[model samples]
Target: MKRPTTGRSRHSGGPNVGRPGFAWALPATIFFALFAIVPLIGVAVMSFTSWSGLGSPEFNGLDNWNKLLGDKVMMQSLWLSALLTLLGVVIQTPLSILLGVWAAGQQKNRAVLSAIYFIPLLLSSAAVSVLWRALLDPNFGIPGQLAGIFGGDGNLLGSQAGAIAVLTFVGAWQFTPLHTLLYQGAARSVPPVLYQAAEIDGAGTMRKFFSITLPQLRNTIVTSGILMVVGGLTTFDTVLILTKGGPGTDTTITPYYMYRKAFQSFDFGVGSAIALVLVVIATAISLIMVRATGYDKMNSAQEGI
Candidate 1:
């Protein structure tokens, strides 16, 4: 027999039934604060001080920043980084989109080809740079063998234009696979009904792609674009192994410049300043992109249908 509830009627669900509590997020928050936040704070503080590799830091106010502002090399490095990043976006985005859509098709051979295409992503940045370096060598490399195409001497690394072009091409070659994988996964998630409806409407492949598939992949495009922009901005390993910021600092993007200052020149203070600046810039750009693209709203691309 059930008694009538007089003082209070009970709720069927638990108080926190549908919501996650703070405990669920506590571990990740702690980990991020310990690693990312702590280091960022240290770098920010270190940027205001003067330190060689050996001594304790001495506060010098804005001296490091002032010096950086006046440095022509620093200014030029910013321009070069922007140019390389732009080149990467312009060249890789559309290519990845096309490859990803095609790779998402119901073809048996795609499995084999996708694996082969992803091999570059498996290789380390250092290894890829070294392989290309050897392959572009004047006397012993592919360039030398195809001297008619690369010019008689095949000295691609000896000039500014040639070195920049090589860097951009290698970057695109190595990273495009990653972006393609992003798009491929996104492409697969698109509902089949959309495509079926388009076919019934007599929409051809190109028409369906631009009208339906591209719209469905909008969020993924934004995500991939952010990754590309940030990765290109901080490119370091390939430059170190392939160009060494060489042909006389022509390829010295900011990350390599920071490495040169901190490791080679032992200017810890200046290095910290550069590192902090980069962090701020990258963070700000990411935030701007998210805000501008409506990514922060977290709305579904397929919301209407």
Candidate 2:
């Protein structure tokens, strides 16, 4: 049986009543509509048109999309994007979790090591890309032994497999710290009492981690995952600076391909179409992740107890 709410309504959200109202979000909502929605709508419209940057756009129906359908590079780009994003998630998640959990501990030199780990995250994307490019250069940066291990002459950007490996490694190198920071904050927030109780139950480190730490970090994991997926799909500067979609479109992910079509090839229509496709794919993936993980409806892990 449902009881009538007296002090405040059941819903703790939305406008009016005893809670923060719609006005609180109105400004941000309007800003988003104006900038994000308006620009997206314009891009959608432009996707169905033919235009270079010099002149007014002219409606061209679905020609742009039709071209994408027949483009092998476009298909390959999508696959590359998916592959890199998957690899990033697979590699970063556990590593970040471990590093973050460790950083949250009272271990010696944790502060110094954590600071070092965070350095890559501070540099701009272009800077990281250029740094890697020089470091991976066969003649100059990478040591001969490491170079041989990487790709014979260490020309990582020269071959599809090596290029893909470099991108994956670089992506993980730069972004792992960001996700680790998220997990660190979350891990720190977890009540020490939980661990104390687990210890009393004869639980080991692995047991406590699996039973308590991981479960408590569910929301943080989902948030970090979403960021990784979105960032991977939209990654461009690294591909441009490091590989240049090079060695015959081998490392050309969707975003880089879109850049080439729009700015390099001067095919604005096709580029706009690709951009819209990327937006749709990213949006769908994020929404699906949120829904599947129950992130949208989830309360704090320790809410009731």
Candidate 3:
């Protein structure tokens, strides 16, 4: 009974429907290629060449990697970086969870407490590093003066072990607030009915936290742990400004070591290789964490919620 059959289908009423989908995605695709793909390819290529920032890179097969394997300082730097990451995850996770729970329960002063906790996140890493440096100074700083009262030195940054510990402390101090915020959000999102039912069943605070709160927040804890581990591994600015990888190569993590290799030693090839190695290490650790935490299953369950 129709007068004529047109080329247009009922599912797609307009001629431009399918074409526009691709057109809409083209810009984002191009931008990603330009910024992410291009730079990554450049780094990979540069890793195989010997280049000082000024001239054409000479192709030099696996020389940089071979040298990296034998370089004791580089090995030490990688080990130190891993140790720092481990220390950060172990120390920060529980503290962040506790702070998050405390803040989440504060009905009257929640906003004020959150704002105070967020202050460290606002400051630049360089500024935080400098502030701590002066605070920990042995000769004329407050810590030094306090130590003098007890016949001890406050120059914690002057010894290798002490410097690494201070660096770890500074890292935890600055980043814990972020994880706390994340945990607090996760805690607040738990259904109020669950807590009400727990209270009716005579569950105490500790019991409810362990039975209800922690299970709900498991994914968040894993996410925060992964982020802290990655940040610990790649951190450079704070360590650079505070310790400069000093106290006899004690605090030199991979990122700082990479910077020293590229700029100080004028060896971009080796630096790029180190950068790639760090990327591999981070990726492997993240994959392991995701698998161990059952992150995919948790994500699906959260989505259903």
Candidate 4:
């Protein structure tokens, strides 16, 4: 016989009542708080002040926030960031998903396909930038020389639209491989039985892909899309080396613009404010992606789909 209790322990209803994993997570929690949370709090504080990173910080209240509203360059950078995020999400997301699906289908040659997809990711961003810079060179570059054939202007990197185009393409190229691998792994984990069933049902390749593969890969797609969004938001290395935010700020996304403000002009206050804005924008974007892509619910629906 067991003794019945009138009242239960406070944590009696929860699975975590005696979990060791929670205890083990304490160190990481403390580390994240110390590094991420503390710095973020400091930045939030600094955003409200007018500190030049040299002298005393003056309390400016909401002055910086108001300034952000009317600052043309800052606004332009935000727009540029938005545009890059759009292009990246549009171009990279579907392409990576398709590549992952194709790689999954190439089971016999999966290793070769994966290696080809991953090679670009292994290269340093600086090297990729240098390669593209040479390729876009007006005098000797292939793209520029090709443009000359169409009677088009040969200096792609030297024009605002061209700079944005090149930067966006480079951004897509660098990030697509990572997302491809992620989706490929996810696709590989999907049961082969599903594909067999689809084939048995007289489903064509395109139908199987659209009806079976795509639905199954939704979670992976959303996860990789979020990653692409983050990459778009903070892209710097390639843009720095390729366009250098040139052609009159057309390609100057938020991060690069913030870098210029903080490092080049030595405007720490404005730079800090821009940094805070970027953080907010990034956070908002992540939230939006989660909502738009149904990412949070995709895992629960993955097996059924």
RMSD to truth, every model: 5.8, 5.4, 5.1, 5.4
- How far residue 10's Cα lies from its native spot in candidate 2, in Å, is 30
User: Please, what is the TM-score per model?
Assistant: 0.86, 0.84, 0.86, 0.81
Question: What TM-score quantifies how close candidate 2 is to the native fold?
Answer: 0.84
Worst ten-residue run, lDDT, model 2? 1-10
lDDT at 99, model 3: 93
Q: What is the lDDT of residue 190 in candidate 2?
A: 97
lDDT of 1 at 294: 81
**Residue pairs in steric clash, candidate 4?**
none
Better of 2 and 3 by TM-score: 3
Instruction: Give me candidate 3's TM-score against the actual structure.
Output: 0.86
lDDT of model 2 at position 123: 99
By lDDT, the better pick of 1 and 4 is: 1
Question: Mind giving the per-residue lDDT tens digits that candidate 1 earns over 109-215?
Answer: 99788888899999999999999999999889998898778886887988989999999999988999998898899999999999999999999989999999999
Off by over 4 Å in 2: 1-34, 143-151, 288-305
lDDT of 3 at 258: 95
Q: Is candidate 1 or candidate 2 better by TM-score?
A: 1
